[model samples]
Target: VERRIFTSKMWSLWRYGILLIIMVTPSHQQELSSQVLLDNISRIVDSRLAILDMRMNNIGSQLNDVANQDEKLMVRLSNNLEDKLAELEKKLLYNLEVKLSAIEEKFPNNLEERLSAIEDKLPTNLEEKLSAIEDKLPTNLEEKLSAIEDKLPTNLEEKLSAIEDKLPTNLEEKLSAIEDKLPTNLEEKLSAIEDKLPTNLEEKLSAIEDKLPTNLEENLSAIEDKLPTNLEEKLSAIEDKLPTNLEEKLSAIEDKLPTNLEENLSVIEEKLLSHMEENINQEDRIQGVNEMKMNIESMEENIIAAMNRSSVLLQKAGSTRCPEAEGFFMSSGLSRQCFKFFMDIERSWDSAVSKCLAEGLVLAEPYDPVMVKNYIATKYGMTGWTWINGRGSGSYITWQRSEGHIMSDIPYWYSGQPGSSTSSSHCLLLMTRQYHMKNYPTQAFYANTCTSKYYTLCELLME
Candidate 1:
């Protein structure tokens, strides 16, 4: 049995992490940028506040001098003396505060809120804080703390205690212990580096891929050679394992063993593993993917995901679920809903409709107007048709038109045309006909205009 290492939880985690990371790190300047910018703003506010303090002191002295002056002289020399002085003092203080705030605004840190929260949670007692901190220290840091013991003065214990009292209660002791335990070695320092992902990981990965050794043409040939070589090794293994009725055993597996690969590798897995590295462990991914493909159960799971997103509503005619939106089935990362290949054809409607149903899709629906248009463009580029499910029921044509859309204006046959109920107008033809004296043709052309013969256009429904 082939080994399968990948689990669903691992897949879920990877997908969930990727989506969460997009929200957190978005646009690659990445998460730390806003925090760094916020820090700079706080730094600027500190500098501005320092300058304002000195200027405010100077203003205080000038205001005292103004107050001492006689009211008569003050009023004669200045207007609204009391109010003006108050206003000047208020403006100076307010302006100073605003500049300091400007710096605070630049920082991502809301220092006031964080400090308030920390204060509320801080441990009150010095002994408990100190004891807690000491308890969390690693054994190696015990020696380091002992070295600093004498440096801490007995009389200064209260000051150290005060600082500890202000420390956040939850991690205060642990953090102090961590600080004491920090390695003195230059190579080791407290850092969040392990938590940080490289900003250039993707680019670096791409760069590595570019640098990887791959032969221009010879590598493909080597890979092809390796395929049969692997087959030989597996055959040898079977030979070694078979019981001693060698002749009968060899005959039983001889024709079947080589073909087992097809059973082991699903078409999807085969497609996925077609891309593998040329290095020593390249077969690891190849085998894993190959095994995943082999599991029809997984493919069915993927198909369900495809079905969920499929627009082809399975109306158990009376069933109560309004169909899910059509575009979703093919949208999943692992599922591909449809593939179209245009065969060179010269056939009638009956044959075409049968051909489509055989492929497990209906005549192309006018849904996915854009995909239909492109498909038609590539297939005939100029034209295509879809069969309508209008027989026995009213005319509800859902053919793949040029743009996966039915033109808003239904074709009004020339005054005398489309009057025939039977054979003459049975077939729908994209052939040229005069409309209002101008030549008009449908995108999909059929040789005959007899409507009874069923023609097929691309229509998609769920598997």
Candidate 2:
């Protein structure tokens, strides 16, 4: 029985060794040919058999154990040793076959062919044989297998845990490196796009700018070309009217100037123009013209200031003084009496009245056209707007000289005169100046805004 067990163990070990040599040998090794693998397996099996034979010979050579022991005890001890060796051999062969079978299946190529060859070499009744051997196995087989099973799961768990820990750390480090690179790559891409966009936009904008002025000039030229003849004529007419308007304003300014300043300015202007037309020394003429222009400008400003003077001191016009007639006092028809109307300065309504009162004279109360004409005749050339004492009180018109004595008739009003509906038009003024055409008669009365500054009219009885 021990011999049969030993033979079976050696057969199993030989099969296991053949499978391991074929399956576990590296393909790159020079000694890895099929013949070499088979030779190696045979050598391993022969070596194991020789070791077992040597061990058996050593046991046999132990004559002292045989001589010292009783025959029965020696046979019993030999049986025990054989049983122990067989048990060990059985476990080793079973474990080797299992591990070698696993490795053999992992061979990627010629698996079917190799398995067929192995099957031809193997016993045909291998399963039946293994079943018979298992039935006769020791009762401790299950316990031994269970111990191996228990040791395998714990070792596998520890190995898996170690692998698991190392794998995640390496994976996390790689992922971190990848993540770090991503933002830099994205930022570089974005910066490149940002750099390109503005340059492209600037190029486009420059192209537009280059085209704009030409387009604008063309459009303007087209519009100008399309303008109607009447529009051009209208512009020409306005241009023609500019000089006339300017002359009229100058004439008005001249009228406002004092008589002496007006005469002096007129003489200087005429002389300058004559010198230019006669082709005088151009530099001298220019210098003279510039000097004269400065003088005229200064005089014009002074004259305007004098004409528009409203805040005047009345203490200079004394109470005992009387209006001078300039020897033209008339006590004849159309007037009870008339004295010279002299006004060199402008004043407000109150100031004008106070000034006249200081002169012991009254503001003229001309209610009819005959009185107005008579009064105007006293100063024939008196022109421009001037203030009279006619004022409105509630619904009644009254003169300052004859308060409460309302006038019976409205003599003459300029086109939109009186303007009595307006609160500002509370006083009366004589619009003596004409513009463009003479519409109103000379010294025509007009209702005016009271706040305006104007020359005052004073009257006194000629005795």
Candidate 3:
């Protein structure tokens, strides 16, 4: 029974060794002809068996050492060694099972299902689905734009004709009427005034010359004769009348003066100095007041001149009108500029600019983007992206058709806008859609690619 058990144990060990050898073999070697693969496996098995025989010989030597001891002690050592070998075999089997399970999980069980899923996600299938959805969308915007273009020209022509009828047809006749209202003898009246000016000035000068005295030298001589000549003799006579003890009298007056005279003099001097300072301050105040008056007068003159210029400008604005053309309208703001919105067609930034230039106009620049936004919203009810006359260089954006930089502080830009000039998108676009959750104003500016097509805005300045 022990020999049978030993044979079964050896068979199990041999099977495990063959399985391990097969698992560790290279894939290319395994793909060899069946007979060649079996030969390689047999050689590996023979080598492993030789090593096993050596290990068995070592075990026999260990057993011989145990044979010198008591029989019960030898049996106990043999059982312990069997138990350790069994534990190692179980551990090796567990590790092999774990590795096999991991490899099995890596590959899918159904190859057909995996291939079908990848095929469904291809580009051609996606394109077909997108085209079907696009066909269902409405064509309302195109119809509306077409209708507007068809009717715009006729309405504009009629309005222009009516305005032309109201304007003065004969400007020469009107000028002649104005000339008739002026005085006929205006030249003669100016000449008479000029004649009187020189004659009046000459007569006045001659009359003054005649009134002057001729004996001026004789009168001066007469006055000199009447004046006193003995001034020194008179002074000597007055000195003789002075008292003999005049110095003594002065000395007595000085002795009777107050003891604090020096102090009093100092106090009086300080008071005089303070009074002088006060006077100087008053003078400064007067001078400042005079200067302020002069400034006020100059300001008043400037204000008057500005008012006169503004009145003239207002009159000119009222008389002038924008050219009668389709798509052109006057600005609602004080600028009163003529603007045209080309909504029916789309063009690139450069192409749009060229079209405007060909038509004797320039691409519209929104110096006050808010005003332009409000005007478009109220007038045409338009809300879409369009190109303006703005371009960027580095961090700075400037109007392509006008002077001055487009300031970043202005609220015209959409959030996180005005991308770097070196980037592909550096041209300016007016975005009329709300892209973010925050409620930003419409017609906000966006940095966009120059090659992208969009509707254009053109400006016409009427002199």
Candidate 4:
């Protein structure tokens, strides 16, 4: 590479020297000198290129030697070559810059532009070579070098500090002045929030102060009565769910309260406030809530009975019914126990049963047909059907009853009734007060599809 560079420099200098000679030559010798100079320059270029070809041949031989080496040695050799090539590239760039600078210094006005142009073109290859070097650098080494560069202070902090030092110390005062320039209402709103801070805190503190003594006594008594077995057990189970210091603080307060009730109450109040703030999260609290719900559900029967009895006396005469045999006997004429007729509400047979069950009742059972017929015809002002708790299943039709076999023996069908082909229409309903030409009884029962929505009649069996 050095030999090639030397040859290139020699060729440039020789050409320049020849041009200078030609310029200084007498006019009569100029043409001959120019022709001779051209031929000499051509011969020099050919010889230099031939030398370069020979050097390339030597380089090829070295490459073949490198290729025949062991893998580890080849790797080491390749790494060394890369390092040397990078150094060479750096030296070349430096030399080129120095030469350009020297040329500019010698002919500042005439050659500065030319020097700059050369400098600009020099970077095209340099950049590509530098990229190759960077690609060959060890990944860890590159990362560490990048980290070092980052760590090297860029004076940003110093500049920021200088800028900050130039700023006025009375910046807050200036801000307050700007705030004062705001509209009066906005300022007033902000002032109101600021002014209420103390009052709000004072109110909260006063509330806590007022409740402290009572709460302390109550908590102490509660701890004594509830703590030993139940609370302690529960505390153990849910210790992780509570604040770590809560049980300890409670125990401490409990121990101190008896001897120093008034004195320690303030401490207890503070602890209690903190404890209240650090409530068990919803997930933990929900566990206890679920347990309580299950307990409440277990007493659902008793609760429903209580609710029913609570509302029983409030019902007007003839509306309330007494438990009689398999059903309730209402003064309104044999309304079944737990049976309620809803004029406005209509539901399918299944839904009607569910609705009744939800209200501690079931759908009305048509046990006493004459009584049911009398109740239905009298009560309803319309001719719509009322669902009853009678369903036909296969050959053995059944009706809902508390006891005793179904009243299948009864001959209460309206003419061609129970409809022999009523495979799908099995649910029974009472047809009330119809005014058709056939003169069929208004209190007739019919077999209809169970899914049909009609006026619901619900029965509530008395406990």
Best by lDDT: 3
Worst ten in a row by lDDT for model 2: 308-317
* List of clashing residue pairs for candidate 2: none
Q: Write the per-residue lDDT of candidate 1 for residues 1-463, one digit (tens) a residue.
A: 0111223444455556556656777686645655554465556555556666767788889988777776667676676777789999999999999999998786546668757856764545756757865765555665646745744445456656754665444454455454444434312211232223344444544544443334313433333232332333433443334334433433443333445444444454445434333322553333333222224223322333334432323222123322344321231122222333323563455566567678665543332322333343444434334333222111222233322212112222222333323232243333221231112211222223323343244345434
Q: Which lDDT values do the candidates have, in the order given?
A: 0.41, 0.52, 0.58, 0.56
Descending-lDDT candidate ranking:
3, 4, 2, 1
Off by over 4 Å in 4: 1-338, 401-409, 434-438, 441-443
Q: CA lDDT of 175 in candidate 1?
A: 50
Minimal lDDT window, size 10, model 3: 434-443
Q: What's the lDDT of the predicted structure labeled candidate 2?
A: 0.52
- lDDT for model 1, please: 0.41
Candidate 3, residues 73-144, lDDT tens digits: the string is 878999999999999999999999999999988655765775795576444556765785466434465764
User: Candidate 1: where are CA atoms >4 Å away?
Assistant: 1-75, 79-82, 88-333, 338-340, 346-360, 363-460
Per-residue lDDT tens digits for candidate 2, residues 49-77, read 77778877878778667776778787999
The Cα error of candidate 3 at residue 177, in Å, is 49
For candidate 4, write residues 150-256 as lDDT tens digits: 55446657756855765555555554555444443443445444443443454565454443332333333332332223323323333223333333433443444
Off by over 4 Å in 2: 1-324, 327-332, 367-380, 404-409, 422-425, 434-438
